[model samples]
Target chain A: MKKIFLILTISLVFVFLSGFNEVVASATSNFSISIVSETPVETTVIFRGKAQSRSYVTLLKDAQIVAVTQADPNANFEISLTGLSAGIYSFGLWADDTAGRRTSTYFFNISITEGVTTIISGIFLSPTIAIDQAEVRQGDILNILGQSAPSAQVSVFINSGEEIVKTTGADNDGAWLYKFDTTSVDLGDYSTRVRASKESEISDFSPTASFKVSKKSVKSKKKCPAKGDLNNDCKVNLFDFSIAAYWWKKSLPKKIKKRVDRKLYRDGKINLRDFSVMAYYWTG
Target chain B: MRISDLKFKLVFSFLFCILFFVFFSGNILAAHLYFKVPENLVGVGQIIPVNVFLDTGGEDINALEIGVDYSRDLLKLKDWSDGNSVVNLWMERPGSDADKLIFSGLIPGGYNGKRGLLVTLNFETLKEGRAGVSLLDSSEMLLSDGAGTPAKLSINDFWFYVKEGASKLESDKKKDSDSPEDFKPEIDRDDSVFDGKYFLIFATQDKDSGVDYYEVKEGEGGFERAESPYLIRNQRKKQEIEVRAVDKDGNERASLISFVPVYPFWNGGIIIAVIMILLLISSGVYIFKKKN
Candidate 1:
């Protein structure tokens, strides 16, 4: 009986000591993982230190392993996951040693989306976008309107055989119009495509529109000015010289011609050639 | 009154209403100035010719005035408003004439208070990277009909970005000038190891404030804080200074080591030759000493 009690006591004490050691070992062996998202895009998580032993890592989303990688003991390791959607997501990590001993769990939150929140919904379809003009001269404002869903994002795509213009968001109720400074666009037929997307989705392309442009610049022949063609009278004789002399002395009848001569010839020489053109015109 | 007279009056009134509807509806359905060229991403030193278009409801406007508000540190102004179309030639800083701008213009022949006109501005870049160009407030004014007093119009301003790089036009021309066979993309591996190359650091939470000076580390080929804050550069392509935080005591924190690989021109042939020479000299000396 005495031997039995002594043996039982020793066994109980030994078991308690072993249990305490095991608890300590398990606490030290455990590890926790977490994820942190600092930007709009969910970046891949990176690990800096090496695992203590050869192990395999498993990335878990809601306790489900979405990705896995093997790592060497005492060797640096890294694995990347394409970030989550445009909302908060919890992620955890666990590493299993060769013997299948697992690590403690970790967690982190991520938000992946642009900060600009746009409200969309009200959209009115129009029969056709009314351009301010059916035909416009170069540098003329090509006003456009028809009907738009109020507060929609409207942009005009000017098809000048190339992308000639792009625009910012327009106020539909106030200024939902796009202007084409025809100076940038060559004289030709153009089909301007208006696109209004509701939620920044690429699939949204507005119905196309077409318009014609007329060149305002006078399509005149490039003629050289003869010296005595005072009124550009087309002759180099005394008559031309008389006109030039008059303009040179004081002022001429046509303001544009006077200004041109004053600009081109400041000294007002008014030589024989001017007189010859003026004389020829005067005679005719 | 006779029936014929009453009928005639009704007909006239109906025609008047129809005409009124046509004119009023036309007036309401007008277009206005929406935006400009270089919607975004303009290059530094590159001339950006912006064409301004107006959306006047079949009317004309005369005389438009434009203004600018920008940072001289980042952008430089050249010339503007050539009297035809509004033109602003901008250059980026650190090179020459780099600056930001606000542009506006006027048109003739429309209701002065509501009509819009287009102004085309050509800008030149001064540097590389991103910056903002906006239309300043109270920068646009329109004239009234009969060319009288001009009324202040509500101008919708815009912000566009600029990215200055080697001129694409020049680059394309260069490509045409140089045959493809003459163009070599190989990296030269014969340069010195330490070619007096320095580092550039950038830290900006937002693009508006721009980047200030970078924190640096000390050494020949190690990290360092940038001497000039505010003027930051992206050094991802080169050997850059790894930044570490400083405490109140001016001591560095035990930070993670950063490693970047850079292969500059030079160092290849010299490294191999130096190794070969050392080996040969060592062997010759060994043979001589043994024989003695």
Candidate 2:
């Protein structure tokens, strides 16, 4: 009986160690990758990346939705945009799960050269994040849920006066949840951001989601928000840059030109000098 | 050999190597812009093909601003090729007045390569004597690291003997047997652009001669030679849009767009829907008053 007890204790220790190793291994395996094609042959481009299985990924150019695709069961996805002129373009992409939860959009600038097909690869979808309550009572639990790559570790950063951090892990289906006890928190506004890391790859930070910690718990959904709002869409992003790009090198009336110059650069032309101002005021 | 003789030989070798490095390293070490011209001399009146190239050494770069000075008296700038250039986009399209030319461009991402082609410039040799092409010191390169850091650079001016007997430069005359490579055109609209009007974007490259111009045609309209971002005369989306890309050699490739059109609100569907809603509201009010 003594020998049997000792054997059982050793096996339990071994099993616990195995689980701990899996966590550590996952933490170390995740990586970040960003690479460009050696030769951009064609004006047409196809973007490939990973998102949650059966989720949808969207491509935005100049602030308009250009294309969207659903990921396969394995979470692999590809989105293509063709008929591009040989020029510089700003593109933004995001992924959405079935629950209407969304990842932060990733923005990039690419110069299209006509001839060869340009392939942009290895993009990892950012994690999705949502809170259970928009106005959580100061002493209640603030529940956060999201989706990410399978078996990834999730870090939640809550900002009040200072920053409070919490950690959780995703299940095999890429779903993660965290419960934060709001006790000892001040009765003020709070913003939360999330990031995910998995074996050999890490995702971008999710967009900021803001809420108030006041007297009662209330449930709501809203995304935290850009400066070059050229379209008056309340967001300054690639979409605005494109609006300017369309007028590139084209002649404008003297009075209108001068007004634009006065507002941005007085160069009286839609040129790089004016673009510099846009870059400076960029909110994204 | 004696110890003194052996020591002298080693010291002499080391000094020679240091001298060579100090004097000749710019050609091999620093990032540089170079021109590939045909041989050392060419006949006057002939087309002098000059291809500009860049070597970034090993650094990734995103932007380049260049200024070129040529012997205006001996050579006149002629046609150029749009194909075979590695430039992603040009901030200032390449142009020349008299003897000086300037251009600037940015790559979306950084470029790091051993030999990247910039442009092919064709200049017609004039009176003949000697001609030269030089890179101005004002030219610069910017690093790709978000921050626009200046790169270490070197330049070499090229000189070629121009002989008197060369014949007139002939044009392939935008005349290639093949049209520009097949390409598609895209339509885009933005409220802040053209006061919320629809416009078109298009581009194409010919492998042999190069693209020269583009023409866009809206429904029931004649094709007009135009640039990208051209405003569409018709916004109704009622007819197919056709775009043509013409090559330097006079070959043309065309793309057409045809899709189902949506009727305007005045076309009557929305009018009837609005009438029904308004009638229902009046009936509801009458019923509510009777019930009260």
Candidate 3:
């Protein structure tokens, strides 16, 4: 009876000790992943965990492999994610060999920083540019417009193959402008491309616009003289004075006389003023 | 059961807790440098307005300088000048006081802020072409605030591009010529106008003699003494007047003469009205004759 009691107590003690050991092992084995980062962006992504893996770990979002690491074996791992957009992510680790097919996966939230939006369509930079007019004359300013991420560099190239003007930034609406140096700019097809960029990305080009600089066109028509034109030649000369003297004293029809009177005097009367006007041009 | 045993247990637990807190309680925030003004693509000659924003506990910033790297064959800088901060124009390396190419003003308080510093930079292009302006790198010294503690942190470098000019010219004529050579002879002509359009003349003067003339022609024979007295002779108007010095080269190099037309108000108006009346009479006469 004594022997059986001792055997029973030893067996019970062994069983209780084994159960306690298993509990400790299970506590260490079971793990969960928690994301300590805000979100994913073009810049960076940081993560932390309650149960981390240092021995041969792989990070995944869905099933895509993001990173593999061998550092921070227990519950802390920092994965660098540059140029990655914001999204949901999951990471997993396996402490066992191929023979032991058990894997631990951690799911966490991540956010990616969205890149800045921009409008850089039609901006030009050149020293000398032609006007859109048929004949761009010298001293005609060329207006170039473009867009960027605001406050971009803009310039105008001159005929000397040099930049004549520089603008610092765009307006609140992201529009930039620069004027042409019309002084040395001749009438020709001057070409330029306005470009803008932020960091590494290049903005789109503005449609190529050209100006035709030429000498001012001559007008075919002329304005009337202050005193009326009696002969009506395009000159204020003796021809006008002679016609006024002919109608000086004639009492013609109302409209006709009025027209004659206006020719003799500036204000419309056949007076001594009419004779004087004729005398001034008598040499003709 | 003894007081000493109880005191030992308490002390051990307290010591362990302090170590854990010391090791893991502090927050590690990241430091980043981002642009403030130009959020993106900027015009070539625009005085690049810039603001360097720092988001972190105050960092020990040492020195900051903005640099632009460009293709020598494509674009060139003439001058850079401003009263306060030095503007460095560059051909290969940036040189100060060359020409009005770039102007720099010191960031108000040297720009150590959480948001950033509003530092305005005005840059003018000497020629139009493609290039880049980079934030480059900044140097800083890490030091403890006080209490004799050493500062510890990592420094990260950042960079961005500044498009000097549009790439259309570069992409199109990339294979034409590397750098701006003498205008191609095929394209170069005595037209005096650039690109078959602009007329460029130089008013040159002798340094010592003060003799001035318009360099009408090119090569050796193009220059004619402007004082030849017959510089401007109008046959129709019988007007002859010698301009003092229309030198087309040297210090007096300048643009050729240009004219704006004069309008004869009264005379011109009368001619137009008369022409209109004559047209009316002719039309009326034709219609009357046809009716008859």
Candidate 4:
């Protein structure tokens, strides 16, 4: 009886040990695959997941193997695919342990678009260009103002010329201003437009703004005539007397009196004294 | 013997649990970048707007390169815009050659959000057919974590159908008939310096179709394209100014204001001469009285 009891205890111990080893082996052999990419992939996609260490990862599209890679030290695996055509694609990811003790297969459906790869949408509008003045004198400053895409670089083309005269960047509010010196521009009508660019995109040219550059007007500075040249025609005649008679008794402002001869009229009135002075040097 | 066996089993069970946990919990979600276009039937000759955006999935990205492929025969690249992009600097300006569009830019501090637009592309349909826009594999997004690590991105392409004789075009034409609301313009005058010139400032707003341009006329001068704050030639004379605000659809609203400029009494040359003569006469009379 003592010997039989001893044998039964040993048998129970051996069975328990074998059961624990089986449980461990089964547990370590378990692996799984999870796709980390968003659905409806265009031309490229990335698959990432976890698998047993030193495991082989195979990616199959429509039952054909496309890629094979190995999991990292931490049992993390990733697969990337590119240049896929447009159609319904069935992707299957299978992870096989190095010892061939475990394997996992994950299936997913991806629909690729035909023809175009990406469709981008947003607010897009043609820019507008406005000038400060429609006409400017030679040697004056011409200010170009306009609105375009925010944070975009704007180039101003003068006379729609091949050369870009000025370049400026638009502010956050999409407003931009550029000042061009008209001293170098010839005296004639010229058209100017602007276009905005950012990254690889260039916007359409803005509407042209036409402006004229006129020749600078010259003012002749000549001394006040001997007396009656009120019109500054370089002659003291009846015409000058008529101008003096028109203001016979009126009170004149200081600015106007300064322009007139102070010698004839020291006081602030136009009377016979001024007329007499005008008559003295009259040349009608 | 039993104690040793129990100890070995405990250690083995712990190791198995650790391996299971590591293998099952190692997945990290990545960001997504894709295109968005109208899915409805677009009409031939219609302008279609497409948007490229980034769904960061809570990652901060600083730089990106996007390449798009399309059918050039069915669609003509009209224009593109970066109006709503978060990137401030362009490493490569967005452009298209034939059927491919490419763009590259960088955001200063990085962007972390959902559905951030990168660019907008406008295309005109050339014929009735289906066209696909897809992302090329060369596209890349760099994380903002100083290492410039490439972010894992899953891209999605889009397909659009163009049809002949679509009703959307008729609706767009009908919208043009709705005239822009009439708005009164405010007038301002600038006469600080007496250079014998002043400016008449007029400003108004058009809610619909935006103000195309402005036309202004002084007196009998023909209506000319003039911006607000028009320069008047004569400061001391009355100016009959008429301003019209024209909308994009060619509808116009006009406003007229008469400006009568007044100069100070000191500005008159004739008035100053008269005052001087009167003063001289009074002085002469006083002198004659004293002499008598």
Q: Encode model 4's per-residue lDDT on B231-260: one tens digit a residue.
A: 665556677878887765677778787877
Candidate 4 TM-score, true structure as reference: 0.28
Over A1-284, each residue of candidate 4 has an lDDT whose tens digit, in order, gives: 55446545655665566567546744532222333344545445566654434566676553235688886654456777665444334445545444332232343334444332322111122345667677788898888876654677888889734454679987765567899888877787788877766655555555456778886533322223434456566544333443443344565556656644453445566543444444333323
The CAPRI quality class of candidate 1 comes to: incorrect
Interface RMSD of each: 37.9, 15.6, 39.2, 37.1
Candidate 1: where is the Cα deviation over 4 Å? A1-284, B1-35, B81-118, B127-130, B147-152, B164-292
| Residue B194 Cα positional deviation in candidate 2, in Å, after optimal superposition | 4.5
Candidates 1 onward: DockQ, in order: 0.01, 0.05, 0.01, 0.01
User: Tens-digit lDDT track for model 1 on A35-101?
Assistant: 4535444334443322213456565442234577765443224556553222223344444444443
Indicate the worst ten consecutive residues by lDDT in candidate 3 chain B.
B179-188
lDDT per residue, candidate 1, B1-292, as tens digits?
9996676567656655655455354345433444555446655666654444555443333333445454444455444322112111111111123233443222211222222223334456566545444556544433323222333344455555566553353322111111010000111111111122222222111111111223554333455453322121333333323454332223332223233435443544567888889999999999999999
- Poorest stretch of ten by lDDT in candidate 2 chain A: A28-37
lDDT of candidate 2 over B94-190, digit per residue (tens): 6745345877654433455656667677888887687999999988877654344667888999988888765434444443566765656666666
**What does TM-score give for chain A of every model?**
0.29, 0.64, 0.27, 0.34
- Model 4 chain B is weakest, by summed lDDT over 10 consecutive residues, at B187-196
Ranking by TM-score: 2, 4, 1, 3
- lDDT per residue as tens, model 2, A1-284: 55446545655665566466546744542223233345644447788877776788988653345688998766678887766655345556788886767787675645566554667777777889888898999899988888877677888999977988889998887788999888988899999988887665667888677889899888875542222345555454454555666666788677556545554456667765454444433333
Q: lDDT of all predictions, in order shown?
A: 0.38, 0.69, 0.34, 0.58
What CAPRI grade goes to candidate 2? incorrect
Per-residue accuracy of model 3 over A121-234 as CA lDDT, tens digit each: 121111111223433457866555443334444443333344444544554333456665466765555555444443333333322344455666222122233233554443
